[model samples]
Target chain A: MDSLNSLIDGFGTALTPVNLLWAALGVLLGTAIGVLPGIGPAMAVALLLPVTYGLEPTGAFIMFAGIYYGAMFGGSTTSILLNTPGESAAVVAAMEGHPMAKAGRGPQALAAAAIGHFAGGMIGTVLLVVLAPTVASLAVDIGAPDYFAIMVLAFIAVTSVLGSSRIRGLASLLIGLTIGLVGLDQMTGQQRLTFGSLQLADGVDVVIVAVGLFAIGEALWVAAHLRRSTGEPIPVGRPWLGRDDLRRTWKSWLRGPVIGFPFGAIPAGGAEIPTFLSYVTEKRLSKHREEFGKGAIEGVAGPESAASASAAGTLVSMLTLGLPTTAVAAVMLAAFQQYGIQPGPLLFEREPELVWGLIASLFVGMVLLLALNLPLAPLWAKLLRIPRPYLYAGILFFAAVGAYAVGGEAADLVILLVIGLIGLGMRRYGLPVLPAVIGVILGPAAEQQLRRALQISDGSASGLVDTPFSVTVYGVVLLILAWPLVRKQVTRRMAARR
Target chain B: MTTGTAGPTPGPKRAHWLRDHSELGVSVLLLVLGVLVLTDALTMSVDLTQRGPVGPRTVPLVVGGGLLVIAVLLAADVLRGGRGEAEGGEDIDLAEPADWRTVLLLAGVFLANAVLIGPFGFPVSGALLFWGSAWALGSRHYDRDPLIAAGLSLVTYFVFDSLLGVPLPGGPLMGVV
Candidate 1:
């Protein structure tokens, strides 16, 4: 009931004519950018960060919420039509959705996805409203040692739990920490790796790091292997569901958010797991199970909603815990920090209007996204027909401008180029990009908590593990580390049984 | 398709295998970066008052040490036939050989943008960045691309500087627009 009242008040702020317009415009821009081949929600938000610079913090965050939902919707559209997902979360949707496109049911797939996004988005946002305050209140009891332990847990989870190789992920994360170390040390005001440059003191801006990695690296990679021709783009019509399609999809719409929100609310629980789980569950239960590989509506419907719910779930953790489980969330966290606003347990209490307003806008953003994109689906497909050369050139062009515009220093462009090169190298070497991003954002904060924990203990290391919360978190971290070796042994025992 | 089987290509393929070992480049990079971090940490002069048991140097030492271990482990993995697969995306074609010339050209364009943005301001240099990048990416519309690039730069300049009040420098045209 308290959450309901706050949400109603939030609507008062979000529904202002100006804020409403920004939400619509963000959805429009996010969809346009998200339709591009390689751009993800993270890149879309990073590139568009400059647009909201002129606004007040509340309105700016409202626009960001809009962009987040829009990117997910746009990514689903592309996956269905082109079999090219802008991010990993949408990869499952493409497996069935693309086959539908090939079979010329492109419009139906889009319809299902848009509706699923709308449905999951609604359910997830409601849960977020109801649950975030409770979580934040629970989080208020957390001390520095527990905070440090949680950050370490986040670091271990992102590196070890998600990626193909833990070593490569850890290496990427360490490199990001090194980059984060370049500026002044937060506690002591000492320079760690400045190399004695005045510009180095301020540190590499997160926008520069993000745009450099996702935009510039992607452009360079594509330029090196530019495919002269492309797959025949499926022509899409207005996305509208028939009676049969609705009957097939309504249950999935409910089930998806139910599966997605829980995973998203936890640290290191990325959308991919719940989304895949949704799809597999749907496959096993559907009467049309045979229709799945051949373009079943349930495959598109289930995963699309699951992914959106997962996106909402990530925000719950982001708003309350300051833990970013996805690349998009990490970038959003950086954006919050840029405005000198810390997002954590204190955030809701500190800025209730902004918090509730941002959450309210998610609901508003979903309605606007579905209403706008359904009829405009064909136009977004037309965006994909944009030639490769112009598209990439524009990416580099904006990246340079955004990098330069942030600090108005030519030095930033240099930093941008260098990070872009590093990003290229990371991609070439198969390093997972998420851990590095998480490291850069969380690196300084982790150091702060570590030192503070020790300070309270008068330099005793046991302070780090004194709390039960810390012990439990560390135990989980150790379990994650040892799981692969344990898994091999378990499998061998099973083989012996066989 | 014809070029694929054009000759007894012990050529690009074998050279690729030999160059495959060049992945040690990443290990070398990690080693160099680790050494740099450690050297910086070790040489730091700290005010004694600022010294906690864990000071500024502590995180760097841990980070640097981690980098070294990972570097050595990665090299061993490479020797034992572990390879990090190059990332694939919608636009990426891993089968195609990397066109280094295009990449180098793009980097040169960016560096030029960095250098020129200071003197020439955003409009002139931004146009150069867009146009140069387009050219590097193989857009040969020399007749029309320059006009579009210039247009884009001016529009963004007006929007960001005039409307948004970001205070972008206009260089020689400082007073004109």
Candidate 2:
């Protein structure tokens, strides 16, 4: 009932004419940028971060919420039409959706995707409204030790779970930490690695890091291997669903949010797991199992819903715990920080209007996305036809401008170029970029929590495990660290016995 | 593609050996970075009163030590025949030898933007950056591209500076902007 009241009030704020316009504009621009290849939601958010510099925080965040959902919708459109996924979460969609498109059911596949995203987004936002307050209330009681433990959990999950190689992930994380350490120390007023540059005093901006690593580096890497052409986009008529498709998809839509919501709520939140799980579950349960590989409507419906649901779910952690589970969420965190807003337990209590308004905007964005995308997907597909050279060159231009816009310092551009080089190296080496991003964002917070916990315990190391919650969290982290080794040993022993 | 293959033909056995151990280059880089971190941490000046129990030095030291351990482990893994697969996530083809010519050209474009932004302002330099990058990426529309690039830079400058009021430097165009 309390959540309902807050949501109603949130709607009152989000539905205002100006905020609605922002929401619509956000959806429009988000879908446009998200349609382009090599640019994901994270890059979209990072690139546009400078544009929202003038808006009030509430309006800006509402626009951001729109963009977030808009990117997910746009990614599916590309996956279906171009067979090039804009976001990793949309990879599953492309698998079945692309096949469906190839079979001359492109419109049906697209409709299922947009509708699935709408259903999943609505359900996910509802789940968020019901659960966020309770979660925030619980999180408010957690001490520094538990906070530190949770960050450790996040670090472990990002490094080990997202990428194939743990070593590369850890190395990437270390690099991020090094970058994070370049600024002045929070606890002590001492410089660590500034090397006497005045620009280094304020530390490297997260925007600079994000734009450099994602935008400039990606452009350089792609330019090196630029595919001359990305073939013609599969043409589609207006999206329409048949009776059989409707009958098959409705249940999967209901089931997807249920599977996806919890994955996003966890600290290790990512859409990949739930989407894969939803795809496998739909494959196993669908009556039309024969169409599983060759483009099943259920495959499109289930995973798209799961992906959007998990995106909404990620907000649970970002808002309540101030932990970012994905690169997009991390950039959103940077946005919040830019506004002098800390998005955690205090955000809900201190600024319920802002928090709830942002949440409410998610709902509004979804309806707008479906309305805009269904009729305009072909227009969005036209973005794919953009010449590769101009597209990448424009990306570099924006990246340089975005970096330089921060404090209008030429030094920022230098930093961007260096970081862009590092990003190129990481991509070449197959290092997962997310860990570095997470490490840069979360490293300082973890350090603060660690220092605070130690200070409270008068420098006792065991204070980190003083509470049951912290102990359990650390135990989980340890198990995550040890699981591969233990499994390997067990497999070897079983083989020897055989 | 013929020119992009790794250096003039070596014996098959030697080529395989080099291919397997190529990752050691990365491990060596990591080791060097670890050493640098440790050296910097050791030389960091700390006021006596500012030294809390953990202090600023602690995290860096730990990070440096962890990097060393990771480098050793990575080296061992490579020796044990572990391999890293090239990413297939994007439209990129990692099997193709990097076009260093293009990469270097793009880098020069960025450097040119950095050097020029101060004198020419964002519009002029930004146009150059855009055009240079496009050229590096193999767009040879020398006639049409500059017009497009200048248009993009001018619109971008006006939008950000006038409508948005973000205060980009005007440089020589200061009066016009």
Candidate 1, A1-498: lDDT as tens digits: 887898888999999998888788878877876677877778877876665466688887887778778888888888988888866778888989999989989999999998998999899998898889998997877789988988898899889987688889998999888888988888778887898898999888888888888888878978877887776668878888899999999999899999988888775547788889999999998999889899999999988898889888999989998888888888888889878888888998898899998899888899899887899988888888887878888889888878877888988988988898888888888888878888888898899999999999989999899988789889988998898999999999999999
The lowest-lDDT stretch of 10 consecutive residues in candidate 1 chain B is B1-10
Give me the candidate number with maximum TM-score.
Answer: 1
lDDT of each residue in A60-96, candidate 2, tens digit only: 8888778888888888888888888877888889889
TM-score of each candidate's B chain against the true B chain? 0.87, 0.84
Task: Quote each prediction's TM-score.
Answer: 0.96, 0.95
- Model 2 local distance difference test score: 0.85
Top-scoring candidate (lDDT): 1
The number of the candidate with the highest DockQ is 1
**Candidate 1 Cα errors over 4 Å, as ranges:** A51-53, A267-269, B1-18, B47-49
